[model samples]
Target: MDIWKNIIIDKHFWAFYYYCKRLGDKIWFQKLDDNRANLYLIKNGK
Candidate 1:
C-alpha cells in the first residue's frame, strides 16, 4: 500500500511538472500575435 501510494504521488508530481514546463514553453518560446496575447492576458486576469 505504501509503495502504491508513493507511485501515485510521483506520477502526479511528474504530470504537474510536465504541464508547467509545456505551458512555460508556450508562453516564452512561441511568438504571440496581438489577438492571442490579448486573449491570454484577459484569460489570466493580467
Candidate 2:
C-alpha cells in the first residue's frame, strides 16, 4: 500500500492515475477539502 498526499496538480494527478491504471492496481482518490486530496495506490497482494 502506497499513499500520496496533496495531489493538487492536474498533470501529477493524471500521471499517477494512468500509471496505476496501466498496472491494473487499485487507485483511490479522497478529497480532503476544496483544494486538497489524497491518492492511494494499492498493489495486489501487497
Candidate 3:
C-alpha cells in the first residue's frame, strides 16, 4: 500500500497523468492511474 501510494505520487506518474488528460483520454488515463493501485502485484512479479 505504501509503495502504491508512492507510485501514484511520483512526479513521472503525474506527468503521464496530465499528458493523457490533455489528450482527452480520460479512460486511458484512468486505467494508467489505476495501475498505481497494483503496486504489490507488480513488486511481487505476479
Candidate 4:
C-alpha cells in the first residue's frame, strides 16, 4: 500500500488532480503490473 500512498502524495499527482478538477474529469490512476499506471478520466456522475 506504500506505493499507492506514494502516488497520492506525489506533487505531480496533485497537479494533475487539480488540472482534471478544473476540466471536470474524475481522475483515477490504476496500477498495471509493477512499473506502469493507467490514467482514467471520467466525466462527472458517471
Error of 1 at 8 (Å): 10
What overall lDDT, based on C-alpha atoms, would model 2 receive against the true structure? 0.55
How far is 7's C-alpha from truth in model 4 (Å)?
4.3
lDDT, each prediction: 0.35, 0.55, 0.46, 0.54
What TM-score against the true fold does each predicted structure earn?
0.33, 0.38, 0.39, 0.43
- Estimate, for each residue in 3-40, the C-alpha lDDT of model 1 and write its tens digit: 22323234544554455565644332222334343111
Top TM-score hit: 4
- Model 4, runs deviating above 4 Å: 1-7, 27-34, 40-46
Put down candidate 3 lDDT per residue, 1-26, tens digits, no spaces: 35455554667666765665566532
Listed per model in order, the count of residue pairs whose N, CA or C atoms clash below 3 Å is: 0, 0, 0, 0
Worst 10 residues of 1 by lDDT: 37-46
> Which residue pairs does candidate 2 place in steric collision?
none
| Local error of candidate 1 at residue 16 (angstroms) | 0.4
User: Which candidate order results from sorting by TM-score in descending order?
Assistant: 4, 3, 2, 1
Cα lDDT of model 4 by residue, 1-46, tens digit: 3344444455666666666677775656443435677654434455
Flag regions of model 2 displaced more than 4 Å: 1-9, 28-37, 40-46
